[model samples]
Target: MELFEGRPADCSGRQEREVRVYDLLDRLGIAYQRTDHVPAGTMEDCDRIDAVLEVTICKNLFLCNRQKTAFYLLMMPGNKAFRTKDLAAQLGVARLSFGTPEDMLRLLDVTPGSVSVMGLMNDRDNQVQLVIDRDVLKGERIGCHPCLNTSSLRFATSDLLEKVLPAMGHSPILVNL
Candidate 1:
């Protein structure tokens, strides 16, 4: 994969959701680097994308409580081990489990392999809460899919916290794990 300064010049075959992410970042005046690749299905695939983007791609999980009423989008270090019990304890929730693909699409407008903080833009109802690991915030830049697994983007962490998230109308709850 090769890194480009911004969105592709020709978006003829790009997914609309991915293009929307680029549009939002441009509108927010947030500078970013982008790389297009095949859908990442494993850690090794992500590693290659990370190498090209020069940032550790976050492991974004779409989860929910047992009742499925409360949904969450979690951004954590790709290398970190995630224990549902640990996060459940921190959030004071009963049982946390991976949400259904249907719910992910309905809430974030993203599918299972494409969960991303950028997807928060589609959550107009504010139904899904953002949960980010503190470790991810320590970095100067963050890497994530642009609501699609076939492409990845990296931007200033500050842009995400101060600009992107705010523009998306979602506030993140920071956790250690």
Candidate 2:
């Protein structure tokens, strides 16, 4: 894989959602680095992408309560072990489960493998609450997909916390797990 300064010069075959991410970042004046690769479906694939980007890509989880009334996007380190009970306790929710692909698409406009904090831009209605792990905030830079698994992006964590998330109108709920 190769790293590019910003959005691909030729977006011919790229997904519209992917381009929109670039558009938003550009409008926000958030400088980022991007790398295009095949859809990342496994840890090995992500590790390779991480090596190229020089940052560990976050493991973004789309979760919902049993009734599906509350939706959340949890961002954490890719290598961290996730326990639903741990997060549920932190949120005071009885249970938390992975959201369905349909809900993921309807709410965040991203599929299972493509879930990322960037997808929160599509949640204009504030349907999904952003949940971030404390450890994720310790990093100087954040790595994530651009609403699609075929590419990944690296940018300042401060830019995400100070600029991007605020511009998207979503306030993140920081948690320990």
Provide the TM-score for each candidate, comma-separated.
Answer: 0.98, 0.99
Question: In candidate 2, what are the lDDT values of residues 1-177, reduced to their tens digit?
Answer: 999999999998889999999999999999999998998999999999999999999999999999999999999998899999999999999999999999999999999899999999999999999999999999899999999999999999999999999999999999997
Q: Write the per-residue lDDT of candidate 1 for residues 1-177, one digit (tens) a residue.
A: 889998899988888999999999999999999998999999999999989988999999999999998999999999999999999999999999999999999888999899999999999999999999999999999999999999999999999999999999999999998
Please give the range of 10 consecutive residues that has the lowest summed lDDT in model 1: 10-19
The per-candidate count of clashes, in order, stands at 0, 0
lDDT at residue 33 of model 2 (Cα atoms)? 100
Name the lDDT of candidate 2.
Answer: 0.96
lDDT for residue 110 in candidate 2, whole number 0-100: 92
TM-score of candidate 1 versus the correct structure, residues matched by position: 0.98
**Each prediction's whole-model lDDT (CA):** 0.94, 0.96
Residue 47, candidate 1: how far off, in angstroms? 0.8
| Worst window of 10 by summed lDDT in candidate 2 | 6-15
